[model samples]
Target: MASIDSKVNLSTIPLVALNVTVRKKLGLYLNPKNIMGFSYLEITNFENFKNPTNEILKNWQAQRSEASVGKLLSILTEAERTDVVEDLRALIDEDVRKYIAFMEKKEDPPVQVPEVDSCVPRTPETLGLTVLDDPDGLYPERFDAFICYCQSDFPFVHEMIRELEQTDYKLKLCVFDRDVLPGSCVWTITSELIEKRCKRMVAVVSDEYLESDACDFQTKFALSLCPGARSKRLIPVIYKPMTKSFPSILRFLTVCDFTRPCTQSWFWVRLAKALSLP
Candidate 1:
């Protein structure tokens, strides 16, 4: 039996990870927000680990130190704790590698005395895009995140939009559906509109979603637009059981599953964290 002090300590896990078998056997009662979701920890780490680089492994070690694994395990069952911890460690490793890469690029010598060519006619507007960026969201202009999916997947997209909207994440999700453009413009304007807008995209993976080429392209474009093209920015919401495999591009993202509600509450808590909401 876990005591109040134990519960408090478990709940205080720096990173959110719930043990399934432990919860089943011990009847752990955690705040609903702390539920777990599919993460990039395993998939991402496996992708990077295969290459076996000293620097990558070192970065993983650093991120692991940021969170307490033992405290994390004490909160869940043996099995759950082990699985979650291992996965979390993998993701931390990937992040560390990315950080190192970024720093290295920053430290590299700057090219000088190089002649620059202007291919196309440029104006202040083109230059203004990079002008003093606001820390707060783009002031009724740009978005920090954008949820994009096929029109067929509107319901799922809508639900996710609603959930995110309720949180404090400072981004406007341009959810495109029949509702956005009801009439004749639906077919003619969808592709142009979706591609032109949306900075970060969330692809809702479903049976119907894969069946459409339009959707495939949209997800692809969104993935391309992602900064550094890291996996987390473009989300994949797994709506059902699947044998499908994502490309290396998307392999690193945390898959948000709607399959098991009971086990999925912690994912929402991470979403809350991503949203930067209390």
Candidate 2:
């Protein structure tokens, strides 16, 4: 167990059944906002060299992925949560060491781009879109599909969108926090886009998205549209194979696997097929 002041060490304390108060006493400070659906009591025993319980192993395996572990570490690093990061690295499996190293290598130094000060503020008006504050969410035009994803999946989504754009797909992508205009009510815009205007929802499924409240909400809402996975409208692109126990919502859905090497043409072919793009 890692010690804080030689007074409270994690080794002596059993993490398996500790509540938030007990975890706080043990110096484990997990952000409540970030760990919304998680029960802190399910921690793996790190003192003894024995294999963890199946439930603990399952949870840990979920956290082992690029989206889960990687995203958490990135958030911690941004927030300067070094203590938690160090303790977590120590507690994690050996396979995670490489992932952490990869994350470190991927970290780019911040570029000092010059900011241009503009008197005119940017808004939906600039984009020629009328901002209607409709509680019932009545939108005029409908898109072919709305993308439900995490920011970490942006690069892949961007590339996929670019590829689709090159062809005759003319996909109108509704990626929140990116495609949406600034200063608009996020909830309102999201409801309008996904619920009202979008004919289909394309989920870029990964551990990060699965853990996110916003992404999960979008997925469930889309799932409600179709009775099951057979709905061609609700498409799932497997950005990464989840180690976590499969969510009931996506269990029966056919996914386009983009988990393999991107250099291969198969991903594009399969994706085009999934989207029904000629």
Candidate 3:
């Protein structure tokens, strides 16, 4: 039987530099059983490099430095590097984070109906006269209403949807906070779901809504569907007092005023009637 030699020239070899012969001979770098001449073999102990915990993984993902990631990669073995890189990539991908944010924000409950149906009959006559007349049927209505509002006005929109649902008519609303799915592109969702499908666009008008780029985008897109000032496709609901700062395009449209306590019922009735719900 032939025995293999595992001797190394210590004078020239540095502990950090794992020469081919050393790597091949000691595949297991820090085996306690191996009486390798190096006294500080513990320094290269592979066990010391255990997989990071969820917290540490999150921290690494949060860091935006490519150089730092490269430094982390260089220290680990090829196999370990692959796993770490994958985990980090999954943790830090922009779309993945967006998906997570979408999921967290989209917690509103879906509309529910009572066990016994409401007596109010669903008929075309119940819908207001100002509602859009779809004679040509150019665009199939995807949602009862597409809600456009700022995050600040989300509470109002949320409550509004709840109120609308309780009425005889069940309003199918595309409220971004509740409608947009995880991993979906928000812009694409807006274009497909709100711009194309919704019969009416409901703008929760407020100072914040006007200030928000997203809210403005939805409002303008909805307006683009109906060019003239008399178009009933776009409905404005006054969530806050924005009379002074109201945009010109929205100024002409008949608005449902929920800003005043006295007009709150009127606003609800107006919106419900516009949606064809008795």
Residues 62-122 of candidate 2: C-alpha lDDT, one tens digit per residue: 3533324344455657767777667655444232433334445548633763665554323
Name the regions of candidate 2 deviating beyond 4 angstroms.
1-141, 260-264, 276-278
- Cα distance off (Å), candidate 1, residue 260: 3.8
lDDT score for candidate 1 against the true structure: 0.45
Predicted candidate 3 versus true structure: per-residue lDDT over 1-278, tens digit per residue? 22112242222222222222322323333232222222344333322322112112222323323323224334443435454444433322332334334445557634764555444422333221111212122212246788888888888987887777544445667676665445545565575655455778888888777788888888888788788844478888887776457788887788888778888767777887786532
After superposition, the stretches of candidate 3 with alpha carbons farther than 4 Å from their true spots are 1-141, 229-231
Where's the lowest-lDDT run of ten residues in candidate 1? 130-139
Looking at candidate 1, what is the lDDT of residue 178? 25
C-alpha positional error of residue 138 in candidate 1 after TM-score superposition, expressed in Å: 12
What is candidate 2's local distance difference test score?
0.54
> If ranked by TM-score, best first, what sequence of candidates would result?
3, 2, 1
Q: Pick the candidate with the highest TM-score.
A: 3
Which of candidates 1 and 3 is the stronger one according to TM-score?
A: 3
lDDT of 2 at 152: 87
lDDT of model 1, residue 90:
44
